[model samples]
Target: MQYLPIFTKLDNKPVLVVGGGDVALRKCRAFLKARASVTLVAPEFCSELLEHASNNEVILTQAYFDESHLDGKMLVIAATDNESVNNTVFELANKRNVFVNVVDDQPKCTFIFPSIVDRDPITIAISSAGTAPVLARRLREKLETLIPQHIGPLATLVGSFRDNVKARFKHFADRRQFWEGVFDSSVVSKVQVGDTQGATAQLHGMLDAKAEPEGEVYVVGAGPGDPELLTLKALQLMQQADVVVYDYLVSDEIMDLVRRDADLICVGKRLGNHSVKQEDTNQLLVNLARQGKKVCRIKGGDPFIYGRGGEEVQVLAQHDVRYQIVPGITAAAGCSAYAGIPLTHRDHAQAIQFVTGHCKKDGQELDWPSLAKPNQTLAIYMGVLKSPHIQAQLIKYGRDASTPVAIIENGTRKEQRVVRTHLGDLAQQIEQHHIVSPALLIIGEVAALHEQLAWFGSSAQISSFAQPLTDVA
Candidate 1:
C-alpha cells in the first residue's frame, strides 16, 4: 500500500494552517469537523474565515507565515498560493517531525485528505494514495446510497450492551453466538426503524433467556416489476430470510436479490393455473414459523392491496407467530408514474379507485353505478380475462363509450407495453395487442395523458402483437 490507513484521535489537538484564502478556509473546515483546535497564520484572511474566528471556532494569528508558527502544533497545512512560502512551511514542519500537507503538492504532503462517507459513528474513508482522488469520491458516493443511515445508532446501541453481554456469556464462543442471533433476530429490524428502546429491551430479554429463539415472517411488498422500487426495510429482510415465499407477480429481477442459500417456495397464482392453493399457502407460512425459520413472504405491489397479504397475516396471528409488514410501492402508483399517466388529475379525475377483476368465489358483485360515475379514475388489477365484461357493464351503467382507456402489460419493467384505446374498444385493443396476464387497466380521462405525459417508457407505446407458433405431432 502506498499509504497506511489509520484513524487519528485529533480531538482538542492543535493544528496549524498557513494562508488566508479560500483554500485555507477549506482545510480549516475539515479540521473543525474532526473537533481539532485550529490556529491559522496569515497576513490577510477572507470574510468567511474572519466570521469563523469571530465565533471562536478557530484562533487567528494575524501575521505572515514563519517557522515560529509551527511550534507545538500536531499537524500543519500550507494552503498559500505562493510556492516559496508553502515550501518553507513543509520544510520547517518536516524538521520538527510534525505531519504537514502542502495543498496541491503531492510530494510535499506527509498526510493527505481522504474521501469520506460519514454515517456519524460509522465512517468509511477511501483513499487512492493521492493518485485517484476523483475515483475515490465516486466510490464514496456509491457507498452513501447503499449504507443505511441507522447504522450509527445501531452500533451505539450495541456498544452500550457490550458489558452486560460479556457478563452474561462468560465464554467467548457463546458470546459470539449470542451476537449472531441478535443480528438475525427482530432486534436488527427494530433498530433499523429507529425503535432503539424496543431493541434494547429485546436484547436484554434475550441475554436473560426470558425470550427464547423463535421464528418471524416479514410480509413484504416487492413493488411492481421494478426491483429499484423495493423499500430499504424489504431489502434488508430479504437478505436475512432463511426461506423466501414468492408469487408470479414479483419480477424475476427481484427474486435474484433473495439470500442465495435460502430455499425458494413459489406459491404464485396465474390465470387458470394456481401453483398452490391459498389455504395451503397460509398454512405453509404458519408451519414454517412454527419450525423456527425466518420466512419472507414477498408479493408484488402493496401486500395489503390485491396481494392477499392480510389473509396470510391473519393466519400467522392466529398461530401466535410474530411478523412484520413492509409496505411496497403499489402497481397503481408505480405503473402510472412509469407510463406517465396520472391516476388522479384535477382537470380529469376527482377520485381514484383500486379494483380487481378477479374475486373470491363468494365475493359480492361490484356496484356498476358507482364504478361508472363520471370524473373518477379506475385502476383495475388482473382485468385481462374480464376485459369484455368490464367494457359492456361500464357502458351499460352510464360510463361514456368514448372514454379513453389504457392497458399496461408488465408495468414498469423494461418490456412494458401500454395499449391506449377508447372504452368502446377496450376489449378489441387487448385482443389486437395480444395482451397477456399481469396487466393493469386504467379507465378515465387521465388515461388519455399517456400520449402527452408518458416519459419513462419507450416511445413505441405499443409492443409487437406477433408471437411465434409451434407445431405439435
Candidate 2:
C-alpha cells in the first residue's frame, strides 16, 4: 500500500497553518474540528480568518512564513500559493519529523487528509493516496448512503457494556461469540427503535443468562483455484467460522478470505503424502464442534464431488452435530470454462463421467468397459499418477488411441496450464511436461473442441500426436 491508513488523536495538540487565504482557512477548520490548537501565519488575512480570530477559534499571526513558526507544532500545513514556500515546509517538516500537508500538492505533502464519513465515534476514512481523490470521495459518498444512522448509537450502547461483557467472558473467543449473539438477537432492534433503557435491560439479561453457545459445522466448497468462484453462503460461513479446516487443494487466494482470527488447521492430502489422516480429521471436527466451536470444513471444488465432503458430513451426523453444506463450482466446470473447453459438445460428446485415478486398496480398477465407451467425456480427477494405466486401459478396451485429451494444471488460476494431446500420449506428455497434482484430465472428442473455443492463460499443447494444435491455457 502507498499509504497505511491510521487515525491520529490531535485533541488539544498544537498545529501551524502557513497561509491566511480561503484554502488556509479551510485547512484550519479541520484542525479545530479535531480540537487542535491551530495558529495561522500570513501577511494578509481573509475575512473568514479575521472572523475566526475574533471568535478566538484560532490564533492569527500577521507576518510572512518563517521556520520559527514551525517550532513546538505537532503538525504543519503549507496552504500558500507559493511553490517554494510549500517545498520548504515539506523539507523542514521532514527534518524535524513533524507530519506536514501542502495543500493540492500530493508529492510535497508528508500526510494527506482523507474523505471522511463521520458518525461521531464511528468515522470511516477513505483515501487513494492522492492518486484518485475524486474516486475516493465517490466511494465515501456511496458508503454514507449504505451505512445506517442507527449503527453509531448501537455501537455506543454496546461499548458501554463492554466492561461487563469482558468480565463475564474470560476468553476472547467467548467474548466475540457473545457479541455476535447479541447482534443476532433483538438488542439491535431495541436500539434502532430508540429504546435505550429496554435495550440496556435486554443486553444485561442476556449476558446474565449465560446461555451455552451452540456449535455447528459448515461444509463449504472453496471452488477450483479461483476465489471469485466461491458461493456467497460459503464465504459467509468462512468469515463467521471459529475454525477453518482446509487441505492442499484449497487455493491461497481463497484461504485469505477466511476470518482473520479464525484458527486454521491444514489436513492437506496429496498423492503418497498425507499431512493428517482422514479419520483424524473427522474426529477433530467432531471434537471441536462438541466444544461449542463453529468449524468450517473448506474443500476445493464441489464438496460432494471428489472432495470427500460426504465422509465428513456422515461423521458429523453420527455425532449429532449440526452442519450446513454449501456447494461450489467443481474443477471440471470451473477449469473448463476458464480454459474455454466445453465438457460436453453437441457433435463430440453426449455424456460426462466424473472419475478418480486413485481408489481405496490401490490397483482396484474402474469399469473400463463403460469408461471406454464412445462419445462420452471422462473428467478424471487425481489422474496424473495413473495416466499410463488410464491410457492403456482405454486403448485395450477398444477405445481409440487417438482420442483427444486436455490436462489442466492449477485450473482457473493465473498460473493455470493446459497441455493438450491424444489419449495415446497422455502419460508421455505428463512426464515430459513435469505435470503436478491438482490437475484435471479431460478425455474424449469434446476435449478436441478446446482448439476452437480456446481462451484464458498461456499454456500450449505439448504435442497433438494425431493432429498438431496451438496453445491452450
Q: In terms of TM-score, which candidate is strongest? A: 1
lDDT of each: 0.88, 0.86
Off by more than 4 A, model 1: 46-56, 104-107, 167-172, 290-292, 317-320, 456-473
Candidate 1: minimum summed lDDT over ten consecutive residues — where?
464-473
Report the C-alpha lDDT of model 2 over 1-473, residue by residue, as the tens digit: 76788898998899999998989989999999998999999999999999999999899999988788899998999999999988988899889999899999898777889999987678999999999999999999978865656779988999999999999999999999989888755566456557889778878888998545546688999999778888766876787788999999999999999999999999999878888989999999999888878889999999999888999999999999877888999999998887678888888889999999888876687999999999999999999999999999999997898999999888887677778899988998999888887899999998877887765423453231222233432
Error of 2 at 90 (Å): 42
CA lDDT of 57 in candidate 2? 87
TM-scores for every candidate against the unseen true structure: 0.89, 0.59
Tell me the spans in candidate 2 whose CA falls farther than 4 Å from its real position.
Answer: 1-210, 457-473
lDDT of 2: 0.86
The superposed Cα distance between candidate 2 and the true structure at residue 15, in angstroms, equals: 43
- The clash count for each model shown is 0, 1
